[model samples]
Target: MRGKRDIERELIHAEAKIESLQTLLESAQTDRQELKSQVTKLQDALVAARAPEAYRDQQIAKEEENRTPRDQAQIDKNRLIQKTTEGYMHALERPMDVDDLDALLARSSMHDIKGPPSLHGNDES
Candidate 1:
């Protein structure tokens, strides 16, 4: 049999691991909830978009009726923000006066393109 000190140390390490696992489990649960919410939103949008033209208006109205006034306001605000973002992207196609590429690098989350890391800090600047 192992010495008492060794047994106690092993028990302590096992307790620490149990605690770490519990923390990770809780974090995973929270992430799952977030993902479920996102999936539900996407599913609702997909249904609304794909419904037949005759039913589309009714489906949209039903969805809107289900939302609280504050939720509706937020939805409207999001749509406006999306439209403004698209306008900004279109504006970027016009001649940019900034001579330095570093100046362009200062913007985070390009409203125009994809695949670049969203780092805005002075990496090459």
Candidate 2:
């Protein structure tokens, strides 16, 4: 009789453990669903923030379709003007004139004046 009572007690303990585990599994499943819903809401918000609206997209398409050769010619003209401006800027940056060249060379190696610079071919002596 004592053995039978011990077996009955163990059986009750095992059933209680199974019930606790089932309750824990249900809670975990509920938490997983809530997390999935939160993730979906966050993804939708991110998409709306990053994507352009349909009206802006249509305006860009219409503008592209309406562009003419005149617009292309204007773009070419602006490019030419920019190239010419860069050339002018480069030219201005260098010593082009003879006096400018003389001044540049003189400044580069300039020292305390000892005597006049030697003139090789232009000497009258």
Candidate 3:
């Protein structure tokens, strides 16, 4: 019963509606992907923020475990040297006076003359 022109008009309208829906679907899909990306980033940030001190310590211990024994010994030696240097710096806060320098030299001379104690308790040289 519908005329040809009426059917053509209806078909054109239907096609337009289908195209609009397709565009909306595409937009929704794009938005969904963006939201998923944002959620992943947020999850990563949350994990980083909530990381415990124990976790960090475990990571450090794991790294130390991976180091060679020689490397660990070298690190220990360096730390000891640094500690000794810091102790010396803390103890000698002020510059030594002439009398202090003289005393230090006297002590050194005494030690040199005494030559270190005899290991076998015999002074025979």
Backbone clash total for model 3 is 0
CA lDDT of 20 in candidate 1?
A: 100
lDDT of each: 0.66, 0.64, 0.66
TM-score of each: 0.41, 0.40, 0.41
59-82 in candidate 1: lDDT tens per residue? 656776787666667887756665
lDDT of 2 by residue, 1-125 (tens): 99999999999999999999999999999999999999987865665577745445555556756876467777677556655555556657975774554444454323233333342223434
Deviation in angstroms for 63 in model 3? Answer: 17
Error of 2 at 34 (Å): 0.6
Full-model lDDT, candidate 1 = 0.66
lDDT of 3 by residue, 14-108 (tens): 99999999999999999999999999878656655788655564566667679766666788775566555554565478786655544443544
For TM-score, candidate 2 versus 3, the one ahead is 3
lDDT of 3 at 49: 72
Over all chains combined, what TM-score does candidate 3 have? 0.41
Model 2, CA-based lDDT = 0.64
